[model samples]
Target: MSNPKGKTYIVEHLDPELGQWSELEYVAIAKETQVAQGTFLLSSLPEAFNVPPALSQVPAFKPERRGVEELYANDKSRVCLLDPSASSDLGPDDGDKFDAFLFGGILGDDPPRDRTSELRKKGFEGRRLGPKQMTTDTAVRVTRMVVEDKIPLDEISYLDFPELKFNDHESTQMPFRYVKGQDGKPMMPEGMIQLIEKDADKSIDDLF
Candidate 1:
């Protein structure tokens, strides 16, 4: 995406376990190329729920090995390009900035029938529990472009991505707490929390 030095588009995923709060899964800022595209699972949740095997491995773009054009040739690939100057109409809703590109079936093996079945099975807890499915099974390819002036990363102070709310409110809010270090202080990397907070806010704006 093209923009002035200070602004950026923080790409993220709305955590299924944590409602309303969008997790800062990835970050995208302006770069010299002026063009950026990546492949992601379009129907991530459903795929995760139905066939967890497909969703086991984390998806990553090997642009250096394979060009974007060739990588996103099929319906399974979800691609998004961020442009700081373009309109914010790339996502599903008007405010939805993040784009859902391709819809893969899922990531890991199917969940066992019960706790005993789970113990007999193999895989981590996070992988065993399939991701929550979105409202629709169809996955839409998404793109987002914004102006540098509109988003200033430095201005962000807090960020959070809570689980989806099942009540009257659209979403629930959760604190982005940091782990305690040996010194008895919140053990977190410098500027990491701030960056997370900024990204969370950006995702929320897009969700609305």
Candidate 2:
């Protein structure tokens, strides 16, 4: 597989309708989360969105108030337009080479007709996650899942993620997280330990 690495970018093509401001907020949060997890994020906000000064200045946030159509026009290669209406599934062949990901960053029961037409004109390959529509944040997470190459975790491995861990003593409301057992040693699952150890061997793999 061609490593996506730094080549993949998530584009948040903002909807022009003023009412979509709430949807744009959801897109922004998703973008921030992806950025934290090491993905590039771009926001193509129309002037109608009136992107506030605070959001525009955020680190790793790229704002293009111009129409998102121009982005595809400028660079068509490896740009995938995510459309639930599209027939293509984002499988290994399509996801590996894709450099840019475009999602209609609007949240609603129905997609904007004009937006779909505009993206279609740009000739970006359209792919759908499934028959059902998903929220902007969910789409972002899915994008990362496809683009990132990693070993799939088993049920036992899932237990080690910090979010899934719980304090052994329910009576003690610890002020901080304790990943170590009562013996004062790291208490992670064996699978998690193996995954951690593999990091040193895979350091040269460049998927990080």
Candidate 3:
């Protein structure tokens, strides 16, 4: 797939703190050149804040004392918000309809906090991926397949709530949707298993 002409994928970083989770996802999101020029991070950070070297693939924009609304105010109609609560699913034809696609960069909450509503209320055209909540990385990949590869939503394969096993005795389940690969595995961001194991081990420590 080639780059979508003049389309930039925007992630409005809503999380208060930068963590391993967002960093890995942003890196994965940056790999799809056909769907985006770059993973543009929009956030309010201190004047001295610098994007981590790992995220060099993503371009960071200062808040400029402007909120997401003000920053995109002029192009509101040209932006598409990926909102889970949206009534419609994004499709291949949307490639030429919008200049940019905006996604919330908040870490997902189980049962979903619907944090995207913050962006949704901005009144950009909204589209849904499916009924399941997906990690930011998966969402970007799916969107790329849909818009740039001209794949229909139903034509895409998916793995839901995949389980991660640390050992024969223990495992944890991710309460999210993921893209399924031809090898029959969930397409996950690199280092995600380590992160999952780290969280799983911490849960054990909490019980002590």
Candidate 4:
């Protein structure tokens, strides 16, 4: 039972805007990840943007206006990027070796537009969770399962493209892979199902 307080987890926000989905994921990340020394930092922000008050507890930096190079400056070699296209799997032993883990703050597209390549192109050591795309929070939790809990990637189970049954006629299919909980259910963040239903209803409204 080791706490992941020793490592710093950063979400490099590349999304055009922070929406409810990203917000829910970040809330989960803030609750689960115990970063080292300071709070969770969402970097590469725009000058005009403000992190909602709910996430005010976490640090959001506009690197253009406020330099944030210090995050990985202390030791860049110890940092790893969770890239889906990476060559190797993130191992359990990697937890003690790395000080910082970087995750992309973009929505996982159904076909995967490779948005992480924005940071991947920057040349940080890259590691993969698997071949499939996972939601940002799922990626973070899976990374913690390896790094913090010392679990191997293959030992973990997953559910892919699970459809959320909003009602008898309305259901939404998630396009990302998710870690299967012991209950044999996709381990989704709180408020996700409701969000799915809301989005599903909105889509229906758009059809009218």
User: How many residue-pair clashes does candidate 1 contain?
Assistant: 33
Q: How close is candidate 4 to the true structure, as a TM-score?
A: 0.83
Residues 1-208 of candidate 1: C-alpha lDDT, one tens digit per residue: 2123221222222223312211112211112112333333222132232222222332321112232233334521223332222233232232222222221111111221122222112211111101222111111111122221132222322222234343465443433322224565433333434544555545432321
TM-score of each: 0.20, 0.54, 0.83, 0.83
**Across residues 1-208, which tens digit of lDDT does each residue of candidate 4 receive?**
1124456667787654677777777777776664423235577777776676656664321122222344566667787888888899999988877767788656365566676777777668889998778888788888888987789998889999888887799877777899998888898878878877766746421211
| Residue 161 lDDT (model 4) | 87
lDDT ranking from best candidate downward: 4, 3, 2, 1
* RMSD, every candidate, angstroms: 17.9, 13.7, 4.2, 4.5
lDDT of each: 0.25, 0.47, 0.70, 0.71
How many residue pairs clash in each candidate at the backbone level? 33, 0, 0, 0
Model 3: per-residue lDDT, tens digit, 17-110?
Answer: 5677776676667655423553354544445545667666444322333455776777687778888878889988887786667777663556
What TM-score would candidate 1 get against the native? Answer: 0.20
Q: Tell me the lDDT of model 1 at 186.
A: 36
Error of 2 at 139 (Å): 0.9
Winner by TM-score between candidate 3 and candidate 2: 3
